[model samples]
Target: MSTTAPIRLGTRRSALAQAQSGHVAEALSAIAGRPVELVPIVSEGDTNRASLSEIGGTGIFANLLREALVAGKCDILVHSLKDLPTAMPPELVIAATPARVDARDVVITRDGTPLHELRTGSAIGTGAPRRIAQVRRRAPHAKVVDIRGNVDSRLARVESGDLDAVILAAAGLSRLGSESTLHREELGLAEWPTAPGQGALAVETTVDAPAELLAALAELEDEDTRLAITVERAILAGLDVGCQAPMAAHAVVSGDSVRVRAVVYEPNGEGRIGLDVTESLNRGYIRRNGSGNEANAADGADPMRTARDIGDSAAHRLLEQGAADFLPRE
Candidate 1:
């Protein structure tokens, strides 16, 4: 393939998205032996700062990119894996998800104050239902407020004293080189499993993308990374919950198997249930090299059944242990 026809990569206008997409483009260029171009598409999530639920949840991030792809405005779309809806449109599929970044959340505050040390009734800001749920459980007394924007804009709130502290993904901050401003709290997955597919980037393409384009993306796929996200998202799709719902999940690849850690929390984060499950990713999960099919666990497994198992076997177990009463009852 010639480096002449640039692969128009679609991405959100946020700094995090740009940086992450830039990284993806560079990696893809190296793999394809050609240059790739990025096309910034302002999404509904960006245009409207309203509640994610009001804007139709996290799927909005994919809408514009999919539109661009369908319209031939861009050849490829890139997104934060966590933000992509569990179910995708039939025409657009995730072609590749390079190895993930830090798959954890970080709390940003002035003077490096830990979450537990904040003054009574101090306000904690976050736009994500998952963070709201998890933090409230850890510090029930702290006030939780919804806030949004790119990482810098959100942190500005704390810097300006508008918020006592704010929670954001550690990966985005690290990607932006702003890790120094935040106190990285390594919340264990058992206590705070992340959203499904968190800390990863998904490269998308039309279902009928040219075979050469598909071959170019092959250089970006990582098997272990694929397996980890597959099971985590598999658990999410199994739950039948939209991104607006209060859900948290994390998965990692062990030696020869994959283990998924997840949580389902109340909106207030006071009540929750979470669990961990390990299965052989190598067993049924296909691993392919160069120009082969990518396994994202998109509906291959029965989500309802897996969710029930995770809820009953893993999550419900936590509930039966009186863990479900931490937050307000539904």
Candidate 2:
């Protein structure tokens, strides 16, 4: 708990993960007046050759890091918010969410061709179910190849002519300083909503973390970013779908209002359902609890409460419109 001691930040060993964690470490060091060191941890997702769905989806990348945190191997864990499961360990808390970057996905092609312009049968590489569904819907002529690897390896496929293009998150490329060098076409969120919490980072620690560390982390929190991701994730949680579900939800906060858009797609991308809704926050309302339930808001006007309500409402509408029919059944 000493202010001079180095804060250990646990992170996945991937280049992208390290880059993101390093940024957070630098910020924390400046705020806490202490050294912040990276603690690289290898996760199952990194070692497994199988597809994400086959190996438990995105959560595979986070479980080991959470374990290390709980076992005291690291004082904190930095996670790509999208990779976290809806349910977290009871002992842990996501203490801070730095301001988010671009939440849009991008198509990187060998010749810089936009996705819609790709020739028939052109191979497009990506392993995420949401992207697979999106690509099939957006460019029916192109072939969707299930592929998995780090960003460099995926991009290398396009560079080596093994694949015509690959879909990747814009944020990952920006964080790794590879965006400018690539021939990418950004996918707008209006038509291609990304996974919940995409482009955001989650800094987590034990509920019992030292007061000094918690205070330092609070300095990193971005209220608007947290509220937006919270709404998006609430939709995911309300749907009760696994991380591999072909679903996308995005939320944006503007002034006193927040708008959320969500979609559900069939595995083949043939059938889909979507909803868009917005709500205004009462400036005078206050958050009363951490649990996202309605009871957490004193008068049902709290911003966080409004976020959860709107998200839950959107999910309920989707279900009513038979969104469940298009999702994978457990």
**Which predicted model would earn the best lDDT?**
2
Residue 53 Cα positional deviation in candidate 2, in Å, after optimal superposition: 3.0
Candidate 1 stretches with Cα past 4 Å from truth are: 1-3, 53-56, 179-182, 284-330
Q: By TM-score, how accurate is candidate 1?
A: 0.84
Q: lDDT tens string, model 2, 1-330?
A: 677889999999999999999999999999999999999999988898797656557478899999999999999999999999988789999999999999999999877889989999999998888888999999999999999999999988898889999999999998998753558899999999999999999999999999999999999999999989989988988898877789999999987788888999987888889988777755444564666554433554567777887788888999999998887655
RMSD of 2: 4.7
Look at candidate 1 and give me any clashing residue pairs: 194-249, 238-303, 270-326, 270-327, 271-327
Instruction: Report how far off residue 28 is in candidate 1 (Å).
Output: 1.1
Query: What's the lDDT for all of these models?
Result: 0.75, 0.89
lDDT of 1 by residue, 1-330 (tens): 245688889989888899988999998888777789999998888888786644547577778778888998998998888888877788888889889888888778887777877888999998777788778888888998887788888888888888888888878887777644545556556666787787898999988988889988977987667767776666566555566567777777766555677777877665666667675433344455556776554335543344334433544454565554443222
